[model samples]
Target: MPDPTPETSAGRSLLLVLHDVAPHTWPDYQPFVEAVDALGNIPITWLVVPDFHKRDSLAFAPGLRSMLDRRLQRGDELVLHGYYHADDSPPPRSVRDYFMRRIYTHEGEFYSLDQGVALERLHAGITLFQRFDWPLAGFVAPAWLMSEGTRQALRSLPLKYTSDPQYLYQLPQFTPISAPGLVCSARSAWRRGLSRLACELQAARLSQAPVIRLGLHPVDMRHGFTRRYWMCTLQQLLAQGRTPMTKSAWLSTRQAG
Candidate 1:
């Protein structure tokens, strides 16, 4: 379980992360999950949003919980995404906050939260998962936008790890594992086209990294181009000798080294 060094040629680890899993989005996400499962032996990390957009909650969705339970039994990892994956705070104060709030899909739940609000949401999310008796592996803020206060709050949370777009961080130690992710933008034709190209380029560039992440959203599966690109990207990675693993497993292996 030694760390994957720069010269290690055994194979690169690829992490397939599905973001924004919730009762409302499960219908759209089900097929994507099946498609990835069909690949066989690939471990997926499902980022579950306990209260998505302040609407859907897992307590009321038995079917969704059942599906997630089955996934866990099948060796997939479940991690906290966000409590209410929607931004309800006051308007942004700084320029960075404005762009993050307005441009990052207006659902940056942890982007502007103070330590207290972030901790409150974190507790709520963890409680929901505890009710289901699901083992929590990590926390990933919505859109990977965590405020400085939220990041500080995470330091004290009893989670194994947390991630942003660029790195998977081992908690307490905060040792970063470089794992750049490639995600699609499927909101519009223009964005989809750009995202497809970006994903292709990023995959090629990060293929040599120790860990490469493929981030999928429910909306990405709805678009033909994005869906095809995702499949193609997976195939390309596999062809290059990348093996799929759960995020938690990857971190554990690295840490145990």
Candidate 2:
């Protein structure tokens, strides 16, 4: 599909996303939230994992839920990330699968799921949101990985949108907005250095795109270097005339177009 034109004449739209948000990770996530809040509470799309690693579930995290509710009240968006943000399938067989499993650290929940399994998990996530009466913007698979079967299942579900590494997709109509994400990898010093450089290059390359997505993980904020890198990237983007936007608002603009 052709890339959508920039919505505003002044600058490109920026979508800030926080991924893998759950109770267990809240301690690590708090600093990022506070930092953003200090920056005028920029609109963030929180990709909340309903059941993180099958170890921490939202039902057991009242305090965290309350905090998230406060953020929602303050205009942050909440979206279903995955039912269990863990890889429970068999070991990877192909080279691509191996890279995803090994390099990505085994968090591809929807990578190998069939249509039925994907739909079942989707419904489970939806039910959890309904139980809390929280507004779910959409579903984003862990590590932005989804199988063909999972994609097929998503087509039949009542979701507003979903995103991959390179694009944000509005459901039903499936209009894609090209917005490559810049994320940090802080697993090790070597990885962090590489990620920093990669993210910088990515930001520079995608600076002129209609929409720019900056994805944040709790781990990314855990390291001093990565955290600094993220701040610098954010400031650079802002200086380039990018305006912060929520995922829902971005989608709405696309739908209106």
Candidate 3:
């Protein structure tokens, strides 16, 4: 008979969350939604749109408000990804931009802005999500970039959590937890392509945490090569009987743990 243990249970279940809902490109999300619905054990947090159309070309669908209503009624959580889902106005003028700006940058250039500015920007985002009657479980910076100010601002806010690959914990206060192991990128290199999938699978196999999060993007699924690789990663996790959880659920579990 198998031993009934908490770690065993934790290893069997993990969270798989999605980001960027009702983004400027809804067409890009259809395949992702279809594949996820088919996958069946996952939950997604529809990070709602704020204002960007008036300021830029990016905006959410006109019908997105209703669609979000349905998802929330069906028991999905909403998070405030960002106001414009972009960095602040009069964008940074340097090889190294601030943390929030770096969120969308391909290269990780380290720079930071004051905490007060960070708080005000975050407040704007929070107010936007409130308009739709969506309770934000946490704030995920556009590209997971965060700085000292960002962290301090979040701690001062009323949010329940904040998630980044680097920091996994509950909000108002962050408590670091062991990741168990690293999650490799399938597209890191030609050699990494073949081996990264195997590496992630092995990590899942040995994990003691209740949920394993693999942050993914719709853009990744849009690419043929990346799509195939991600599908395999999902399959490997599913094979281990790991359940995909939304961002809120995943963070909640860690906090409780």
Candidate 4:
């Protein structure tokens, strides 16, 4: 296959990434995979948590590993999510921090980590992926939140990229890819409604962009509201000539140009 030319309209990339992927979340993710498969053998990215919340580790999940292996064989990409998808930071110092840490996001594993801690967690997550020999090219923090220290640590790693809610950063130099992600919120009825609306707006807004990102979560798959919404969103974007590709693949083409 020829490499995509990012400068052209035909090369606008659609990055559909599954978050919080682990053995414990496998069942929740099945519907999502099936839905995407319904659209043909479209490629997707799996943001895998090596040990979610420090409890559900991939080591004990042979079944999930088998499933992931098949996904990779079919062209899906695996990315290292935070080591322990749970946040271990101390109490927030202000109201703004509290809302971001405990309300807006339940857990931002890399949100407060300095370089030393971030590197340690990154190494631990990489070790788990290596144990299974899963090829990992990217690292995305849970909740799309990472500190400057985490960015500093990632610079020294061999990772291809990392992302926040608003941008995908190429590793080492951290070159910014300007595309805010579309994510679902199952926290409440209002949040869900608002999220769907925001998704539509973001999708339309990015119609001419070089890249468009859709971040799917376990909770989003379990609910019918978000599940159907995303499937339709996928259809709409595909109709607009969006070529779904893994984040690493997108970067490859971007650099190839």
Q: What do the candidate models score in CA lDDT, each in turn?
A: 0.84, 0.84, 0.59, 0.84
Candidate 4 residue-wise lDDT at 98: 88
Score every model by TM-score: 0.93, 0.92, 0.74, 0.92
> In model 4, which regions exceed 4 Å deviation?
1-10
Give the C-alpha miss distance for residue 189 in model 4, angstroms: 1.1
TM-score: the better of candidates 1 and 4: 1
Residue lDDT tens for model 4, 1-257: 12322253337778888998989888988877887898887899999988888889889899999999999999999999888888898878889888889987767988888999999999988888898889988998988788889989999999888878877777788777665678888768898999998888877777778878888889887788988998888888888877899888887877777
TM-score of 3: 0.74
The residue-by-residue lDDT of candidate 3 on 3-110, one tens digit each, is 222332243455555555544545566676678668764666665546543343223344766766776776677777655555444566675564435444532211
- The candidate that wins on TM-score is 1
Model 2 has an lDDT value of: 0.84
**Over 4 Å off, model 1:** 1-10
For candidate 3, list the clashing residue pairs, or say none.
14-211, 15-245, 16-245
- The TM-score that candidate 1 achieves is 0.93
Best by lDDT: 4
Each model's RMSD to truth, in Å? Answer: 2.9, 2.2, 6.0, 3.8
**lDDT by residue (tens digit), candidate 1, 35-123:** 77787878889999987887797888999999889889989999999888899999889888788899856988898889998989898
Full ranking by TM-score? 1, 4, 2, 3
